[model samples]
Target: MPSLRHELLAYAVPRVRRSRELDDAERERGRLERWHSGLDRSLPTRLVRHLHQRYEVEVDRTGDFPTHVLTPRTHDVEATVVWMHGGGFVAPIDAFHVRYADRLAQQLRARVVLPDYPLAPEHTWADSHDALVEITARWTASGPTLLGGDSAGGGIAVAVAQSLRDRGHEQATGMLLLAPWVDLTTSTPSTAWFNARDPWLHLGKLKAYAEWWAGSPEDLARPEVSPALADLAGLPPALMFCGTRDLLLPGCRLLAGRAAEAGWPLRYVEEPGLIHVYPLLPAIPEAARAWRTTEGFLGRSFG
Candidate 1:
């Protein structure tokens, strides 16, 4: 059974389906590109104000990305979390991303760094992968760090970790993924089936973005683009969250199984009736519960 809040929250998102009657692909792409540019321009001001209420925010430009370091209002910051913002590889970072990073930092007594990575249509995975690899590598080198992100960012986090592992470098102490879209190809049965129930994700829109992020079919099969096809052995312990109503749930299930087979410590929590990236939305009660679970996992992992 779904929580009352979760059930009610579904109604807030418009039930806009992909149809030829609405618009064409070019129009959709233009709209998304414009929206991403606007959001990128607007997020810094809004996020700085919101994050300052809880922590000191430091903004630094690293290569092609802008990194926001959030040091919480605490004396002992035990760890560092390099959190990636999810935008389906096309959308812009939102207030929810900032809030989640701030709250998670506070909960774990850790400093959080959120990076503004390049998005699709304008930029592809190739354009942003090396920068993320460098960022995660630098942070993980200092000590044990938690690598985290939601949706496309989650996928990026995993890809970065895998690259580091392949290079014989330990990248992440632990990984926290929120409704990660591990398989960009969406080759799973549930990916298509769950589209009807998932209010936030549309298969058609997702396919378009996936193509933009991954330039070719061969690119989709690359481990850096889709972690589902990557070897997972010897990586850090992971905690993953996904909702049954999310289009990516099936891929997560496959990932859990693959991790188990590879002897990786991956704790996958599938919420029965929740939506995508529920924890990012603080208004929902499930978000609190998810945060509590994440905090507990971090505590035990650190201990």
Candidate 2:
């Protein structure tokens, strides 16, 4: 017997998880090719198809890993934000993640690149990694680079940061993660607590994404596969926000503690009553606050 809000969140969680199972995102890769069919395709030939429909942000097609840059026409553009979309590892950059990116890009006054990184079951998903690496390498030699994303992409951001560190590049200024899927292993109390309340996502969907993205021991332990398990030392500071209602909250907590113990400034936000990547829904007041908080965190000096 959960309370009403608890019960509603609990109920909403499964619908969200089922959306993963039934929607194009959680849709099994290769099981269906493109996320949208020709008839389903839009007049605008690109990732942010409905950009015109959205009045606030300016979207441009950047041909790298099917990436897009979302910027505010009126802003100063102080920094750059690279966004990775989350769908376990099987989903594409859907509207939910896009809205978050647009809002962030506009608010932070930073040029933002949102890459629709390939999902699993594709031979090229790793190529998506290479794509990110290539792009990041270009930025590594420069000023403050902020890496952010939701779910799997957030994990990828961590991996990207780690990759830079391993290469001795030290380019990233900070990481902003939203309920990031840091652990492919998926072992945590929150995972089980939100097990029933997450509006979308479940062990089965999680397993499906994992099966497609990783196989064998090497893959499982690969730093990119689960940065939560990866050594958190020497990484830059991070602001990781997770809802108390998300299964991945534990992952966020563990990674934050690991980073802090390793002596990096890792700020973890646990919104008391929200669930997975709640910031995506900008219409929500909490989501708006999250964006403002993120801007404040990222607005400071970065050499």
Candidate 3:
């Protein structure tokens, strides 16, 4: 029998897809693109807010955009996790992911910094990638830097790590991805099966949004734009976490296979039954365990 969570998501996923007001696929995607822009401040925040009670929220707006730092009491701070929050490059930051950076910071006993990068339609993904690179370079300087995020951020983290390796920077220690929506191709077989099972991201919505993101195929194929299509060669070790019910399951499996082919160490945690971005729901029992598992992996892989 399917877990309650999976059943619930299965029921809820189609509702979100059918709820789209736009009559045509193209227009509906454009509407979602605009709708995602204003979510930065309002998307739920408890996962991080709860953890914040035990730690301090530090902001470094000293740069172009708002950059927040979460630090817990710990002696070792040599390693850092440069966290990029996920919202399909459509929002500044989602509340679902804000807490994750905090928890990881507290558990790893290392500094964690999150960049408030822009999302889709309003700005190009190239703009977002540049901002990511700028902040990641600074964050990794003090010590080993681990790249991580849920969903889109996870994909971004992988892209940056692959980029650094390609340049021979030797900075990326590893990457932790949670239900990462990597393959923008939208042709994977899972699209038909998990599409209805996965909530939050609709294939129809993403396809429309992705096309709007890039007017050209070449632009979309850029590693930073779509890590699923990016060459996994010479990339840092990666730990990909995806729920069995997530629509992204197949893409992650493909990423893992690429890592193997490229000779990159790959660690995957496919929770038997969960939904998209479950790691951000650390308040839940299953979410907490998922985070602890990642914490142990990060501790061993990072400095």
Candidate 4:
């Protein structure tokens, strides 16, 4: 049985069904702009701001994207963690992203870099993937590194890692994917079947958003857009989390199978009845456990 806290958190989050109107593009873009404007005032940001008072977080924007570097205040850093923020491929980073990235840096005794990647509608993968490749190439040079993200960001994290491997660059030591949207094409049956069941996602909205982000149907097959279609061999070990109720669970499961077949080291955990990206919620016990487990995994990789 899922934890009562998980159930409560799931219920507390309002459902995000697909809008029936054809003007969703304009409306979604407007909403995204609003979300970006209010992120500094969000509760998660406030709490993390309070907790991270002692840490050193340097904000850098000299590169292709805005990056936040969170350094552990206490302990010698063990590794670097580069986490991408998920906004369904079109949305910008929010308070939750800052909180999670900060927490990961503190807990893992690592330097955490949160990159604000290019979003869809305004930019395509061509614009973002190259920037990411450049950023990861520089970050991974320091030593052991972990790549991670939630939802669409998780998809980006894996794609970036694969891109590095393909280029003969040193890949990340490991990866942490939370409810990754690995397949944008809706190729997996669960993406469609679980649409009504998922509290925060719908297949109709997802497909539309993906199409907008990808810019065309053919681009969905590109490894940077959908890492599920990319070669999974010879990348670093990975830890993946998914919920049975998430519409993207089938794609995650498919990736898990591919990883196993390719002899890639992947630890995948699927929590029954939980929502997508549950680890980002922070209030639930499952979320806490997931972070702890991730820290342990990172420890093993760094050691």
Task: Put down candidate 2 lDDT per residue, 1-303, tens digits, no spaces.
Answer: 224554465566557645644344344554544542222211222445555454334333453445565545564667677877787776566766665666665555667677666556563345567667666656556555678878888998888887777777756777788889888777665667666666666666675566568754357657878888887878777888887767677778888878878887788888886877877753566766787778788776353
User: What C-alpha lDDT does candidate 2 achieve relative to the native structure?
Assistant: 0.68
- Tell me, what's the RMSD of every candidate? 2.6, 4.7, 3.4, 2.9
Local distance difference test, each candidate: 0.80, 0.68, 0.69, 0.80
Cα deviation of 20 in candidate 1 (Å)?
A: 12
Answer with 1 or 3, whichever has the higher lDDT.
Answer: 1
Residue 33, candidate 4: alpha-carbon lDDT: 62
Which residue pairs come into collision in candidate 3? 48-99, 89-119, 89-120
TM value for model 4: 0.90
Report clash pairs, candidate 4. none
**Which candidate order results from sorting by TM-score in descending order?**
1, 4, 3, 2
Query: How many clashes (backbone N, Cα, C below 3 Å) per candidate?
Result: 0, 9, 3, 0
TM-score of the candidate numbered 2? 0.79
lDDT value, residue 274 of candidate 2 = 80
Backbone clash total, candidate 1: 0
Model 2 alpha-carbon miss at residue 149, Å: 0.7
Pick out the ten consecutive residues of candidate 4 with the lowest summed lDDT.
14-23
